[model samples]
Target: MTDTSDQLPVPQRIPSGIAGLDRILHGGFLKGGSYLIMGPPGAGKTILGNQLCFNNVAAGGRAIYLTLLAETNSRMLANIQNFSYFTLTPIADTLSYLSGYSVLEQEGLEGLTALLRSEVRSHRATLLVIDGIVTAEQAAPTVQEWKKFLYDLNVAAEILGCATFLLMQFEEGPASQPEQTMADGLIELKVRSVNMRSIRELQVRKFRGSAFLEGGHNFAITQEGIVVHPRAEAVLAVSPAELPKPLATTEQPMRMGVGITHLDEMLRGGLPSSSTTLLLGASGTGKTLLGCHFLTQGIMQGQKALYFGFNETPAQLMRKMTRFNLDASRFVAAGQLELLWQPPVQDLLDVLAERLLNAIQRLRVKCLFIDGIGGFQRTMASTERLDLFLTALFTALRTLDITTVCSVELPDLFSPTVTLPQTISGTTAMVENILLLRYVELHSQLYRLISIMKMRESGYDPAIREFRITDHGIEVASTFASAEAILTGIARFSTVTPGVPPAFETSARPLQEQQS
Candidate 1:
């Protein structure tokens, strides 16, 4: 016989016609093979199938689109032309569409098979598409009929040696039929919600005889068709390069002055640059005012700073700061300070990351302040809310070599038996410094007490200091000594016995004699 092996036609590789998608597929679908596309309703199943048919014809291979639910060829063409791809006249002319079977009628599957066979032979078709097999299933009178029709159709397409694509609508639960088992390849489209926003994902569930990407990737549909953004984990196999060496001057630790001279002295100069500082206090305890002082001082030192306000608008914030004698309008007008007032309502991680990146680029900021962390609690899951947000925020701020200050409202300031939730208090230990602000009773009057609870990599004064908000901003008053419970937000004094000597003399005497 003539050399039969040499007579076999070479297989063709048809392009998916989607620029980004084609890159992921390593070219496109293979000729003389079958594939299945599974997704829920409104997942753009029909549109993707139509693009495949049109693209094949444009590349010099004939295509036949067999639709069970869609309308006639003219209607399909008119609808798809709205997309820019209508200019491909060659594909438009060579493409053939067939759809007239009623799924409700028992003749739907039979009619499709007859039409498919005829079109395959007449056009010598290299590619075939079944717009939807689910439509046929819905039309069948009984489950038995549906199973038979699906099995027969699968065999017919395989025997014809035409590269076929079957579009199926998947239900919410598991796949009931063996359709997925029979197909050579299966692509699944899924939708998921992140922070109340829907995200589209595509996963290659199965692809026989080919090394395919296994995980899901993000994608979007636009007027030009479907576009897929490959997951970072999929393409970036090598680790990133180590960070660049810091400038000679930056290698020496810098001080982030606390905006007030007395506070800086209490902190032993100031907070370290590139460090995270936690300011803990109750509501209306001047936490925001302290943060504003930090930002204003940073701007004055020629370093750009950012202030994120969760509770006030930019205009309102500026007006409020003016009352504290810190004019913020000058720094804003000078492009040295940026005020981001809105609390992110979307994926807090994504929104915060994006905004921080933008601020670093636009303002060249060196310091950042989050007015309060409570606003972000609702945006993330409870278990990971605190740690995840803190880690991400810390990492981003560190990348810019920026000092970050975060203020948090404490539930209880002095209850010895009360313990804060792990999510709320755990992040405090992660910072380089912790500043505690409390309302203390001194001389039978309530005064603000400021103390440095923790200071890493530096020494700080641990004694509580009295402070007040004055016309010139926050000013520290002289410290006082008392033998009463004054730091617990209340002041009470006990009467000294007549026989009790001075505190110094009582220590020198015996315990029995002092008690007597």
Candidate 2:
């Protein structure tokens, strides 16, 4: 038999009271791990250090926040006193704050080590944070001395069974830093500027004795503290076919109607269940009202819905819905539909994704209408990652069995061809169905036309139809002439023979079920 006495079952973890943080850290920090948190000034290093101490002490465990040649303890506390996490009562018992500048100056490395050991052991600290640790590096006259001090701190922290965090200002090529090699993990925070906006992001460069999610993740410093928003692509990895069919309120079905009888007919009875659809249109082309129809139809089926819009406030959307007699207030009052309006402002892509997903889970929503999907492009970290980001988002929604309809803005109607941003051109495949809504110039009047561009999993009507937005909402034409019908259609794409005119088909095409 193997000698398993020294082999522990699993490493214990220290929970950091940060939202979405433990998930990225693979269940928080290893109990005896030593981590280096490095970032530039105003990058949230001091706040994170103090917040972690507060979190650890709140859980009945002791924590120590030590500083060497840095701001005094009272000043540090004053800075973070306004945060909600600050507790005045706990500081007397479970938490300890001290200055190590005197010991470091008097006895150098050995004296500093002795002070740390004595304080941590006396308080029985489970967590330790050293703020402004960069001072120690500069005080050391040689590289070897600095390396030894870091090595000693790591060894002592492990011996005391304390998870320690060493906070310092951002350094150039941090991977080459001495503490990086000695510490058990490295976390770097940055505020990156792109165009006129600045985004805060975090990356776990290294984590020992456990597996952590790699790559950069966005974070925000709020009143409570730092909140991490991991990339959706890394968190939601289920492929389309692999996702389970969703409808938490009812048994799985094949199709759901969009509330418009004619549009449903064009969609082969209704849109496919648990599928994503893109409603592409120019401004004032009735795309938003069409999306409202999708949401209302979902509520009629006993499914909850969400209308997430960027440009329009909830009041504006509610007014528009009322104008079309959608009973928007009743649905809202009954909790059948929710309107989440987030302006196109200082928001990160990952942050938006996390919030949307959380709302879906909270309300058990089955239908979602993302009014103006193009709004997401405004804050994407990079245009190239949009495809992956959208793919992951769609995958997560599908896995939850939610049916989503997203609207994209096209150029002005008078333009010969609508040109979309180059970034959005590649995301066409991310959605299951594609619908086109355009305004047609016919006989000095603008006629609204709707067409099914593509349906990956189902067959749909290929012919275009004229639709009108009445006070009662959308109404699609029922019939077309059979005399070379599709060839005329006001002559834009329809080819008219020199002597012949385009006639319409009067009969309806038989609709079929989606592919099983």
Candidate 3:
């Protein structure tokens, strides 16, 4: 008797049966509550609602999908048959698809509410989806009548403990309609033009009684229905305090070779394991070859590896690697290596990040080579979120203990000194190491030169060394100590001793010859 009647009921969550969607909702929608889904035509409102209904019904709860459009039931079935979720048993038995258009036109809003109440009771349905709520709004004589009808429907749904969905046709931004006020949650779908391509996004405008993921999450309508790709920054944001404590500083960090002895020596042993490295180079400067060497070295060390190629297909990359005598197909067949080829064709950055992370986790990838960061950037519509995206991505990699090397093509090869492009989203600071590969003209010959520009963890050799790609692998030649302008894309003898030939020219001989 202690004010029990005034107690608020516990909110129950109903899973949408969609992985990312449930996470966005912080679980799922509140059960026994009416929600509104607003979107423009062809914005996937109907598909989303239908997916939820079918998923609920499949989980042993009955559902009623009432469409206010005048389309025939057979046509609706045919239209939905293409989706992978559509099944004959659920459609014929567990779920009921009814038309509310005739009821609204003939009997008006009150009749529509009565029909919903009767159907909910008869079917013993826990889920109710009213598609094309715009028709009922139009059929009502006044705004007050529509509000009354919405209130009555909500009451009826609440009485039956049925989670309800009202799909409304919205062309633009959020509207201040009475139905929205009456609903417990509001979901909006949008289609926007990005770089001449349309991208579908979903947002939760309001969700009562629960904390939800805000902002827009990209989605797509595939044969499996709606799949949401939550932005990594929003989904995986973690505070530094949340990260696990590191080991004692006295314990030396592990390192891995880059498949070249001299390069490893310059790196003070080798690259620090689990560190992120940026390979800044121009085209034809052996960036891809360097990445191949990294992956092959990992494979040789019995570590799993992943090569995410943006500009080349798996077959193409493997064929290219054959020239270096690195046969990746064996490791690929052994399940120790994964070659993922994704071209920059209307790809979403969030989707790419999710896919890469998933692969890394599933494959237990210890070494990762992302060939062509520039190609990945081409897929993004805006660079504004790139910094946050990179932060989240690198944090995840470090947490997973994956050593990553991403190759970014320099815009101009003829520049005197290398500079991180202003267009790059401040990702340089996040990288633990920076290796600059450039084309330099020395003695009327274009040669590849590499220099360790920065190493965060420890000191590294700052010498500009000549490198050559051979049939076996990449080999580092003698340092360009005689060439003062090595990094200026133009080179000349720094100090000449008349009797001594150029050090690089003499040292550019075969490895065996130099050894001899």
Q: Estimate each model's TM-score.
A: 0.59, 0.89, 0.89
Candidate 2, lDDT over the whole model: 0.82
| Candidate 2: worst-modelled 10 consecutive residues by lDDT | 507-516
Question: Which residue runs of candidate 3 sit more than 4 Å off their true CA positions?
Answer: 1-10, 171-174, 244-249, 478-516
Off by over 4 Å in 1: 1-168, 172-252, 343-349, 381-385, 413-421, 441-445, 477-485, 488-516
For each candidate, what is the lDDT? 0.69, 0.82, 0.81
Candidate 1 local lDDT, 312-426, one digit each (tens): 7889889867877788888788888889976555443334445556777788889888887776665443345466556656655665688889888888754433344567666
Ranking by lDDT: 2, 3, 1
Clashing pairs in 3: none
The candidate, 1 or 3, that scores higher on lDDT is: 3
For residue 424, give model 1's deviation from the true position in Å: 3.9
Query: lDDT at 135 for candidate 2?
Result: 77
